[model samples]
Target: MKELMKGNEAFAEAAIRAGCRFFAGYPITPQSEVLEYLSRRMPEVGGVFIQSESELAGISMVYGAAAAGFRAMTSSSGPGYSLLQEGISYIASAELPCVVMDVMRYGSGLGDIFTGQSDYWQAVYNGGHGDYRTIVYAPSSVQEMADLTVMAFGKAEERRNPVTILSDASISQMMAPVELPAMACHDPDAPAWALKGKGNGHFKRHTSVMYYMNEYDGYVRAKYEKIEKEDQRWESLETEDAEIVLVAYGISSRICEEAMRSARAQGRRVGLIRPISLYPYPVNAFDGLAPRAFLSVEMSALGQMARDVALACGMRAPVYSMLGGTRLYSCSDVEARIGEILGAAHGAF
Candidate 1:
């Protein structure tokens, strides 16, 4: 049965169902509810929850817990998310599998407590100082908030690397009906690489400086390549015959979908491509489509996701940007922008 739940609460409960036994996070706007929800619930399930003194402390706690073989997680927003970058780099280097949720707010350097998609570059690209990449999922609805939290935990373990759920303030605070997943338990000692006590003598494992080895470099490269080839995910609507395709994710994608339907009703050849995975970046979704123009709609001052769309199309089509910054674009707002782009395209010929 589906229950009405806030987005942040849904993510927290979903993490528990996915067997996240240790959660460490500091409070931040638009995402504090995650930590708040976990505080009251983790103990009920015999899981560990810590309201850390800082984002840095929270992420480090997660690292330690994950190293000890527990499924661990952390949540933050904006600057708080920025503070986790260094720890994230360390966790990635250590090859630990854990989950991190960045409920993004607007702007840079202590941005406002409002929804924004500006963290696209930070989440998809490694903001941490490393050559490693984390799998990133962007959820547009409350249902995805629950669904993708479960998937993030599984993908993190399967790939043996940290996974991120990049949500924005709007989705993080909204309330909707969600069917939560079944509860499960994780065995901390299941992984061979996990730290065991001194009882297992003559064998020791270390997680640092292994990347300095030439062979490990090749292994990491191959692993990311495999992920790129196999894990790209997206949703396409009328793209098969679209002349102008709008590329978006998170809340912006929802608006684009509405605009697509509005345009289609009036006989406009508009389409939508909503990316679910940001790291491997659903490049495959662009396959065989020869749209004349690709428009990137995002809530960032600069269209952060436009570059990826341009690269995915191999510059075959001119890519445009519809930036919303601290606000969201309405269906009419998106529809008007599409008409303007189409008008300009017609004038060019």
Candidate 2:
């Protein structure tokens, strides 16, 4: 069975399918539909839905709910996400598990109700005040938006870490028919690894870093190092002997994909690496690209992931980027940039 659903609504449905019983959030577009959709459905299913005072308070409540050990989540956009980073870091530090869906819009300040992948760095790089890390899943389509949100909860708890669903305005607003997956009686969203509550179990203690250099320095490095070791994923398209590659995640990857198709029409051999998980970024994936590959790092932001890709690729090939401009990106934009990179591709290998 399939139904045409908004990306945000699908995300809520997917959380339900994943057995997410507790949701705490502050609404902000274009992700507000997700928050609003869940608000009604959760109570109908005997789940708890909380609309908190602010993004900070919302995630703080999420922290409490997650501490109590219910498969929990929250949703927001760029500005809202900025507000929630404090709690996100706290959740990461305490090693409490939760899922967050950042249905991004175009903005570094204020807010734009339009499409963009500008939050790529903020979501993956742990854009909070202190040192922290989380797993980020970028979804290109509405179906993926729903499915990824559900999977994020499971993966977050599996690692006893936070998992993020990264979708953009286009995907969130687009209507698509998504087939919901059937779930078993036993829900995997809330796993045995988390501390549910003190009801059947003993009370739990939660704490955050107090910034003692002597006490926290080594632990910080170890946690960050551990994060770097796990949670990296990428998808290879036409990668076999592909000389020049386009690297992107989220909605930008969709454009890159179409660009590859167009380039192929003109008989240009282009490849793409669409990273699914942003943190513990797929560095090794780029390393294995064909020698002539100069990674075209595409995003709607000002060269955030590009810098990371360059660090990952080193001198194997140049890492070029097309970033920071108004308006939604398209396959034509990708084609032009890729044409530029290919023009200079020969000597780099």
- Per-model tally of clashing residue pairs: 0, 2
- Model 1 C-alpha lDDT per residue in residues 1-349, reported as the tens digit of each score: 9999999999999999999999999989989999889999999989999999999999999988998889999999878988999889888888889899999999998778878988888999978997899999999999998999999998998998899999998899999999999998889989766777748576645465464576887888998999999888888999999999999999899889999999999999998999999988999999999988999999998889999999998988899999988667899999998888888989842
lDDT score of model 2? Answer: 0.79
In candidate 1, which residue ranges exceed 4 Å CA deviation? 209-214
Please name the candidate that would achieve the greatest lDDT relative to the true structure: 1
| Cα lDDT, model 1, residue 142 | 96
The per-prediction CA RMSD against the true structure, in angstroms, equals 1.5, 3.2
Worst 10 residues of 1 by lDDT: 203-212
Each candidate: what lDDT? 0.90, 0.79
Tens-place lDDT digits, model 2, residues 1-349:
8999998898888888887888888878798988788889999878889998899998998888787677788989999999989998899877788988898888789857788778877898878866677888888888887778777877877777788888888788889999876652325334444454467767656766444246686777776677677667778888777767788887788878888888988888888888887887888777666546555555565777887777777757777887744755667877887777777665331
Error of 1 at 28 (Å): 0.4
Roughly what TM-score does model 2 have, to 2 decimal places? 0.89
State residue 146's C-alpha deviation in candidate 2, in Å.
2.4
TM-score of each: 0.97, 0.89
